[model samples]
Target: MTKVISHVGFSTTARAGDLATLEDSIRRIVDLGADVAELALFGEDLIAGGRIIESRAKRLVEICAKFDIRYSVHGLIVSNFMDAAHLDWQKAVAKAMLELCRRIGADVLVQHSGQMPIGPRPMRERYDALEREALSEIADIAGKAGVRVALENIFAVADTEYRQTPSEVAETVRAVNHPALVGLIDFSHGYIETTRIGADFRAEIRAMAPVAGHLHVHDSFGRPYTMSKFYYTSEAIALGIGDLHMPLGWGDLPFDAIFDEIDPLPGTALIMEIGERFEAERADCLAKARDLAERVNRRFAADAA
Candidate 1:
């Protein structure tokens, strides 16, 4: 029993165009006792037609190099492998993102799991197969770049018909069977999805824990969004209607129970993805994350004893 989690940190919200802001964000994360920074590279401007802009990439490297923290990249959120028409382009973007990770020395690139298909059963099956094929190729590129691609679980929304459950994502990673491809159990997403589908929440998480190499830890009441109207995110927070990304104690998620039940693989990066609105609570969130990591390590130590 050594430490089960290698890094406990927060995601940075700075955009590519604002290098100064990005530097400040990283400095704040480091000041808050975070050893890792999860860069949210979800903007379209970072990649152009499936290739990273070299100038932007170089600047990012220089900024990140100034910090003593580890790095992880959250790849383009809209790059969907399920979109059969754009699978090749998606693969190209994915490869380019992996190259960016290599350039910036990020060890993990977080990718969202495939979106649910909107057609017949056969079409859904075809999409699943396509995603696996695409990931296999992407994983090969990731391996060559010394980066691990962690497929993250996402919940379904009103517009999006459905999303893969934790078990389904785990199965996909296991099917790919590549060391460079692993599961990322976003607890908030798992809670929302399991609540939507009426599946056992803790059970779904436990099933996926064994394959988890990276984790997005945030607090969300297990409430899915509906057609109800909400003007601001604060309104959603008031009603607890969606993935609020609230601070740990701000939501009713049983984080203690979650850490008690699932043990992610050793060296997993447990990054807190608290929303930007909760910026003032960064120190508190970091402490809670450290406590949970210690709990997991204590459990492992006990098991070994």
Candidate 2:
């Protein structure tokens, strides 16, 4: 059975007292028949002034267990805000996340690779060393806690001086070469990251074959590809350029072929890693996920036939 996990990003709410919001979001996801919920740590309660505590972890665990949902961590994108090359904060956050994952019974942690190293070293050399060391350390720590780490490759426009390609995602995963760490592939991010690589999506997935741990599944989005001309951040956030993390099949993410490829991989988790869901779109999104899963199962059934 292919299990579908929903990240709380679906609700766009990530606060501590936002329990009511998360409860409502989980209800909708459960109603859609998903068996897992991804808990993001950056929203509200999980992290405070650059640290984590037991109370926040306990609250999250109780909520997920109440819904009979498996949990994972997703909001630990400390790299985007920090110096990726330095990696002091990245390692710290990863360690905190593994502890949270252990306490929550979530064996998976999904996160983006973040912007590449912005240091004084050679670009590729710096990226290679930083990613290798950081992920290797993360893997060792997570292995101790019996958790898996999945690195997501997101698209972003740089100040021209600070940008890294998605193929580096494949590159770094290969460089690390660990069983505890793997790749988390998203449609939009893969497309943007590999735009310059000339490799197809199937090739991208295959590249991470040895360490392909979990998946952040979604359909293609229609985000703006146009640069904001005035602002780098605006350009990065433009439509379809980055992973806005829309609902499955709602965006143009090309899941049909992608799913077909992964359908053969036994036990690979499919996480519906959408950004934020609004009250207006909640019910419909749930219905769509159910319908999409059924559609996937039927194809598998027919393929088996």
Candidate 3:
């Protein structure tokens, strides 16, 4: 069975340094009936004052174990391995994050595709070469640590910068072709990408499903295209137009269509990337979200049977 997890995006906020917040969030996730919990750790948690601290990493391990919850780690977005200028620093941070993953018994470490800034020239070969090399090295470390390094697809403001689309991400994962490296599809991002390009959303999910080792489960109101923009409004919020990450059914995303297109794989981690907008009622919202996900899982499983 696929284990559903919920992410606590605390690392991007002031609460990243607060253990109490982390604990409370994890407790809520478990209580919401999730099978696992994911925590995003930033570079600050790995290094400080120009030094690495195993103590801090160990504390996180202790906390997760205390609650008896299975967990995974999402490396900081700044831990980019594609850019040569910051490759060394980013690699170091990524390595430390893998160490944290090992200590926490996390079997997967989710990462964003290497940072490839938008440029004037066509740089596909150059970018692919860099990603291939960097991900290979990262994969070796993850393999040795018994963890898979999952490169998640992201929606780039410039589509050419990185592998943003589902097929593009699947291609990149195949190019790396490492046993310890796999592709992760952010459903919300995939939806936006498919909608923007007039592609079939189910086909997008099908393309990535074979290599999908993990998922960022979320919802959006409408697709955000590269050529246009939509202003935020109270009305828009109610409609869940943007990457709202509201409770599952709050948006118009075709969750059933996407799920039915592919069978759930064993050991796949589904992280509910519910944005912090629901912080005031996070517990209530998460409970509802979990219920929806469970219903979908059962429906899909029965369909497959």
Candidate 4:
């Protein structure tokens, strides 16, 4: 069965200064009927002065044990591997993250692929080479720690085209060809990138499905046009081109189609990456998400029968 996990990242965004509060916030996720928890590790907390916080790593382990919640860690955004200059720092951070995963008993770590420059400079081939190099090192780290590292698809924004679409992520995984490295599908990111890049959403999902070890499931209405905005603006909402992390049905995503593609897989994680806008209604929203996951599983079983 696919494990349904709730994201504690939204809560952490507010309490980034005080990570201890994550313990309290995550306990709420367990209460909401999620089978697992996804802890978002920002670059600020995980990467500093070329090292990881040993004490904070210990605290994270304690938090998971306290709640008895099986967990995974999302990689830090600031430590992206795309930048050539950040490659050394990124490697250090990756090693640190692997150590943390081992200490905390986390089996999977989701990482965002590096950003693509707005204008062509390093060339796509070269950039891809750099990214592959970074992933190779990370895969080795994860392998040694007995954990898997998932490379996520990040959508392109105005200034930079974070060209790591689902297909690209899959191709990267294949190129890296490491057992410990796999693809991660973020629905919202894939949805937006598909529309922008003129790729079929279903095809994108299918291309990545074979290599995907985890998924970031969230509702995205349309392609976001604005820059540096988290919440959907009034204009964007009216135009329906924003990546709003609303509830499932709140958007026009074809969940039935997505689940259809996922059903045949060997049980990938279904993690809800709801935005902070729905923080107040998190419990209720997650309960509905859990129900949706169960419903999908039942349908798959019925189809198999």
TM-score, every prediction: 0.95, 0.75, 0.81, 0.85
- Model 1: per-residue lDDT, tens digit, 59-162? 87888899999999988777677777888888888898898899889999998987864677787788889899989999999999999999999888853474
Each prediction's RMSD to truth: 1.7, 4.8, 4.0, 3.5
Between candidates 1 and 4, the one scoring higher on lDDT is 1
Which candidate leads the pack in lDDT?
1
Q: Per-residue CA lDDT of candidate 2, range 1-305, in tens?
A: 44332222232246555766776667766665556666656664675544676676677677777777666777565554225545676666667778778887887877677564355657657655666777788889888898888877666554333444445676777778877877766656676555534456567655554355566655555343444444543344344455555556555666556554443233445566554543456556556555545554566667776
Q: What is the lDDT of residue 257 in candidate 2?
A: 61
Q: Largest TM-score belongs to which candidate? A: 1
Colliding pairs, model 1: none
Model 3 per-residue lDDT tens digits across residues 246-305: 656667777666665554344667777764555565556556545545654676567667
TM-score of 2: 0.75
Question: lDDT, candidate 1, residue 247?
Answer: 90
- Tens digits of per-residue lDDT, candidate 4, 1-305, equal 33332222222232664666676667666776666677776632755655877777677677767876667777776557778976888778778878777887878888887776755655877888888988898898799898899888877766366576788789999999999988888888888888877788888888987788777777767575654453536555556676766766667888766765553234456677774456676676666656656665676667766
The number of residue pairs in model 4 that clash at the backbone is 1
On the 0 to 100 scale, the lDDT of residue 75 in model 2 is: 55
Better of 2 and 4 by lDDT: 4
Candidate 2: segments with Cα more than 4 A from true spot: 1-12, 15-17, 80-86, 117-121, 159-167, 196-202, 221-225, 228-242, 263-265, 275-305
